[model samples]
Target chain A: MESRALGTGLNLLAFSPAILIYVYTFPYFYANINLAVLVLIAVLPVVKLLVPKRYSSSVYPVALIIAMLLVIATLFYLINPSRYYYLEIFSIPLALSTFFAIDFAFAFIFIFEGLLSKRSSRMIGYLFLSLGTMLYELSIIAAMHEFSLTFMNALSLVFSLEILSYYELFVYGYQKFLPMANFQIQINQELLVLFIISTIAIVFSIYLRENGHQRERLGDLAYSLFAGSIMGTLLFAVYDYFSYTQYQLSIIGFGVLATFVAISRTSRKEKNRKPKIK
Target chain B: MIRKTGYIVLGIIAGGLLESLFIGYDYYIVALMILFFVAASDIISFNTGLSRSIRNVEVRREIESNSARKFQMRPIRIFFTNRTRKTVYFHYYDTLSDVFNTEGDFQGYIILKPGEQTKREYSIASIAIGKYKVGPVIIYAEDPMKLCISSYTAPVIDEMIVSPALSDIYTQRSERLSNMKFTYGIHYSQKIGQGYNFYGIRPYNESDDTKYIAWSRYGILNGEDIYIKQMEEERQIDVFFVVDYGIGMNQGTRQKRMYDFVIATVMNASYSIVKNHDGVGYIINSSKYDYFIPAKKSQEPIRKFEQTISEIRPNGDFSIFQTFSRIKRDVKKNALVFVITPFSYPESFRKGTRKEFETNKKVSLFILDPYDFMEKRKDDVYSALMKNSGLKHYRYLTALSKFFNSIGIKSSVSREKDLLYRIMAAYRYGKLTNEGA
Candidate 1:
């Protein structure tokens, strides 16, 4: 029972950065309405966690799809929130559910990978999942600075959780004793690294703005929140590097080559993989 | 077919078109970059995966024996080799004949690398006789993320036959019979014959041979009547087994019937009589074919016997008498005839035995009860909850037995436990008591 509580706590911790960034998008949403939407966003996931997967898995996906469709409809119709307050409120969860949907997909992979327990096959599964999941973030790009930061947050968390959970280290009591070939599992100091990386990024972004990179009223608060969401989402590639020693040689994949590879997003050729059996 | 990844990609394209139409060119660049990423990573992997079809996976199935004893466990091994240079992951299921009960797994998931070989092994046993066709393995090769699928069925089936097992029952019984144990029914009474093995002395009768009179006992008796020396006959017992098969005896099946027990019983008896130098042969009366082997002493007839009984011939007979009369010429004059039938038509049995008796041929009847083999029992010796049909068969057979007694033909209804014992004993008594005549 206590382990179950710890597992849920870690889960909440895992989702916190996206929540902070999502709630940040809506400081302009009006105070009482912002509070109402925040409660709704926060409470829905908690309710999902409390309910059984048989009930919750179907409910969340259906709700997420409907919200996504409605938000798209609002965009096409130009639903002016001053005229239609409900449409405005609906858009709030839509922004946050972008995080919800991607996280939900990973949740499936985490559980399924453990059951399958074959590393190369899992890598094969994740290769497609990571590539497919990135499309949602790319599709949501709205020319807003907030969307850019939120996109980074979602992508980072997807890969980070992928790294942490792949080795069976994410679940509270689960162990990685199952026989798998060519699977390199390393210790992850992610929360610590995420804290340091976010601190450095916030200061760096502030310095860039001071040096006149700023074209908008992007303040210290926005930079800090965006940095926090970044820690929540992207370039934990250092964390990624440290966590998988075999992938460390790809550090030679740093600088121009690494940038090209990450930006171009090509498939990596891994050698001497263990044969997978079901 | 559109894979899961394909659906996600299409959804992205739709979102890209809508966002570019409504919002601006700002997020358009990001969507393009992501789209380019998807095209690069996925299409390359997808193309390579699609090229390696599941047909390239070779499967070989092996069983140690072409024939297994009934209810004996046999191990089966299946080796899977990837003939293609590419690694392939697939789910395989080896379909087994329903008569078999698998002792371990026969189906699971596995991945084979280029030129890699792996084998899965399991054991299965059948409480049945005759041939079992075990496999034509079904395989589905799935791409890494289950993004694409291909299936192939390997035509890898093999057949194994199961025949009834005859243990050392014959060896033990034949040895004891040769030692002259008077083991017919429960009667332990000894019989006198003309051969050389000495038996106890008996009072001389008018028919006693004068050369066999006991002189020492006569001297001791002095003025008393003469006594004669009796001897145990060492002659081969000629036994002919008439095994009934047809709708009357059993519904057609190779095993799990009273007929299978009768086959086992006859095989045991024939083998025992052969060990004792007795001439033994059988006639299987099926619907369209009558498998007949003439009485002979050596094991040469046993091989033919095995081959005949191994086949699933549908037995045909108008009556037990027809089977008896059909092969009566092959039956030795003094051969004790053993007829094994379910006696479904009791009148047919009565008529059959009456015809044989008129010809002055001594015969033994074994009325098989199909109910004894069909019912499941918790305790070893007792019958299970007796069904009404079973009761009717039992009552009818019991009445028929009494009628056989009235007509002077000695017979017993077959029960599984005592059936072999009874046949062995009847052959012994028939040989001991009738060898001289």
Candidate 2:
């Protein structure tokens, strides 16, 4: 079989049994798999064919998009239970976790192919996409649980402040913009666990792919993924802290310090020495 | 950096507006965090510098010049040292002159660890005669992400002398030389001079050295009379290379220029003639520069001739006719002259040949076929232009060659590939034909 086909087949074989278990355990999920979900899944192959061959290798972004949309749709149904006949299935944390775990598996495959191909950009893009999708799912979870207005405001304020803080780190601005005061916000442990699991899966895939008997070794992929994951987790923590406590600049300030440490660790990965010329 | 940062700011604002309109503050916070993470990664990458680890760089060439008969593989080695604490990833390449036909890798990436040195080796073949400088190594350093790059040049220059490509044409050239009766064999000049062959006996004269007093002949003529043996003096021919360096002569690709072929032919011919103890000289004519080396029978003149030819660049503005017209008075009678040019200009061909013929010299009009040196046409408008110009040049060259043949002047058309054979043939034909003599 062609390498891409083999990769896809191997990936499906590795994760399909887990998905089957999830479907069998939750009989409601079978009924809840709506026309929209089926259509989205069917569109994956079509999108892959439409894109150029060079970009067809990574199918995770498409799967992740579908998963994110399903989670958001589920949250929307929770807001208005009458709007969705299968609203109870959407609200189940187990079902949501299962969907996220499947998305995480696809993300692992995406990163695996990227490392094997030596395309650093693809790996970085997958990381960013996963982080964004997970954060969006977190917000949906918070909204579904009927968080207070002050908590929602703090989440939004700290989110924007975090962006501005990172922007200030790279770009010089003429004037400084102060952040709003923070309010108490609670952490969603279930969502946090899912995000961490996905991050670990992505990193582990990179490590495993590098260790495979490939002609060229991508030793740096594991280290970069590890450092990027730490940075991502630290960013999540800072967002949580800023949302739960008073909106002091020190919240984002401490996050930047942690980011420096993560970056330093990433740089510590050993570089391959120049080989002797034959 | 500014562009990516601006896009992120714009995205944040758009996300903020969307959150305020429909989704609550929670959605906006999540969107901002995502953007912040991306921006933070980029910021960290931007601050990461590629350490100044390259402390020294050096390049060495194996063979300076190839022998006449075979192609010489010139091995080049590039050495660089990294002295910084961090690993440095950089790309480096060596600059080469057009005279070389390079094989193997000239440009490659190097991953240098802290306090380590590395060397890369490659080989190139000298395809033409020239003096060329082979380097000032260019190095480009990039971060692990390849986000930003820093470039530096190491001014490590080495000189390469690519002498004229020589082949085993000695036997063929000698055979051709032997076939020419005027050039070799029992040709009598009627002058008793320094020679190996006997001519006749003459009375001992005041100017005759005692060495030539033919003691046996004196004894045969009796003690009362002394006689000298007269030996036939071999005619020492002076070969002159009248090279046209006009702008029209530069009509070819950089790698296979007509001027280069002409130089190679002239250098090889000079080497052959000097090997046989004949005087060789050259006259280079261009609008900007004109040089003349008088004919002399020695190894020194041949060395100077080859050196001068190697340095000649094709940028002449003057016509070949004008150069010949000016040098007509200096050309001696009965001398062998090879007019090397790409007879592109018909007027120059007519006037130059007429001037050389008027000087009573044995002129061989060697036309370097420019169409042979021209690059092959691809399906393009520029290719059409080249095709049209090439056709016109071909027509002019054919007509010129016919005219020279009709007028009984020895002429031959040569391409860069078989220039040496054509030159030797022209020399043989010019020497054997006693038309001007």
Candidate 3:
């Protein structure tokens, strides 16, 4: 019973930042959805307390499914705005869905990291989940504005790819450190690409010179970075060609770099790793 | 501690720089202010020492150890009180030892108002017999934003002992042996008197009761006999359980050990003897410690005997012979001494039994078969080597048993799985043989 309460509290802590961000940046969106999210959050703990102890474990998954359904419905509503006649009532569901989607995402990430992982710390998990959610929201907003018929359609295509690729990146990052955030103020895309290529060259030369003795750490990092940069460049070039935009290419490049780093880091086996203290 | 909100603020500052350089918007300051407020609130909360205030607060834990049963769920309660003026988010986790099988619900979190007290309850069960420590409650405190998280370890720990489950041998044996005469207690004298059982006829004496005179026997003897009827006497028996707490006794898997089986057997026997209105005692010998409880009748002694056994660990360095030699002088003449051991050291065991026999003390050795108690591993080279070693040990145990039989000493080998049944059968056999003699 105590553990259940702790899990719930930690999940709430993870979800709060996302909700606060939504309310502050998008008040109009927040106004529509605040009631539903608040009620669900408040009622969840009460429902856990009121239910028979035998059925307590069922609460989390059930709440998660409900929140997912709300998000899906809101996405559908956003896709077709002209179909609903009762704008006020339709707006409520739309707001509620959007709120739950972001909230549930953070909560699930925290649960996965803290309870199910080999290590118990949730700090890395929180970082990736937060960044992923932010990127996802940014993609949605970018797609909402119709720059042109062809450009808008291309943005949607990129958004779908970002969802799949970034979600995978988040999962990988939760397991191990990917070193994606170098804290560079100005992201230089051409310079990053050149560095990745040069690093791959140097790593290949070292591998040949050392007979693959350093394959576990340095070799894996170089190969993954090289592969990820090429993929990111291809994706950004395709999107830019259709949408006629070049400014957002750096963001896409960074996202791809992070993804590949995560993939490479997760693939290597960590021998004699210590269990993380909570 | 700054969390993802800090990242958003940094992103906004970068976005503002980009907007000024390229697509300038007049109301960018409004967006910046909103992000700034969110980040500032988190930073302020962290800098204000919210976590420190929570650590300074006191916590108390309470649980009932006696109510816990072997292989049964028992509930434990913990209480946390917040004396600070600030409202705090608190999480507490109570660590459980491997001896218990429990669900992952022994921790909780709560937002306590100032001076608020809360009690949390969790359930746990003992899956094996042994003593366990459940404690050092880990406490975590943070503000609502979770910007600054601090943890404190409360040095409070509690110990719980799970005794083995008692068997029904006591009640069953007492009923079966009600007709037999037990000549161990002071209450019933063996001499014919006012006891229930009829002994035989004897010539009437001055002290003989008139009511006990067998008129029929006297008539059959043509009045020259003048005999009185004698009856068997009932008496209390003193039972001493001599336990060997050696390292070898600790053999076997984590779920079941030879020492565990030995403790269970001794506890069951003690319960049966004490239940039958007899005095019970114990002689526990370990490497660093030795405990001796003289045989005494009553409920308090039985409880103490169980408590002591539950806390005992296997650490004996001295051989069985040395342990017995030290406690041999304390054994009463007519008292029934039960030596419960795995007989890991055969030579020491033989020597100890011989010494006890020489002293004329009625001793029975209940040997736990170590081979049977050992863990059966999966098919591997290590397991095969262990199997070969076990076979050799079994051969030695057989030889020891035969030696005891030839020397006219009572002994029995009990498997770990059927320890209780074997102990009961041995006790019944011993009673039957003593009665027959």
Please write out the lDDT profile of model 3 over residues B1-437, one tens digit for every residue.
34343344334433432331121111222222222233233334433445455665576767765445466677778778888897666677888877677764588767677898888788778755667777777876543333334566766677777766544223324454542233233234354357788878888899878999988887666657688888876655666777877776778776777776676666656656566566778887767658888887765665676677677567766465565575567775456667777776655554334545553555667667777656776869868888899778767766766766666666766666666665555545444344211
Higher-ranked by TM-score: 2 or 3? 2
What is candidate 3's lDDT per residue for A240-273, written digit by digit as tens?
Answer: 3433233333443354345434423432322322
Q: Supply candidate 2's per-residue lDDT for A141.
A: 32
In model 1, the Cα lDDT at residue A235 comes to 28
Model 2 lDDT, full chain set: 0.53
How does model 3 do on interface RMSD, in angstroms? 18.1
User: Which candidate number maximizes TM-score?
Assistant: 2
Q: Write the per-residue lDDT of candidate 1 for residues A93-212, one digit (tens) a residue.
A: 445444444343443343333222222223223323432333233223221232344554544543443454345533432222211111211211332343234333322322232212
Is candidate 1 or 2 superior in TM-score? 2
Q: Give residue B385's lDDT in candidate 2 (0 to 100).
A: 86
Of the native A-B interface contacts, what share survives in model 3? Answer: 0.00
Q: If you assessed candidate 3 against the hidden native complex, which CAPRI class would it receive?
A: incorrect
The per-prediction CA RMSD against the true structure, in angstroms, equals 17.5, 12.5, 19.4
Ranking by TM-score: 2, 1, 3
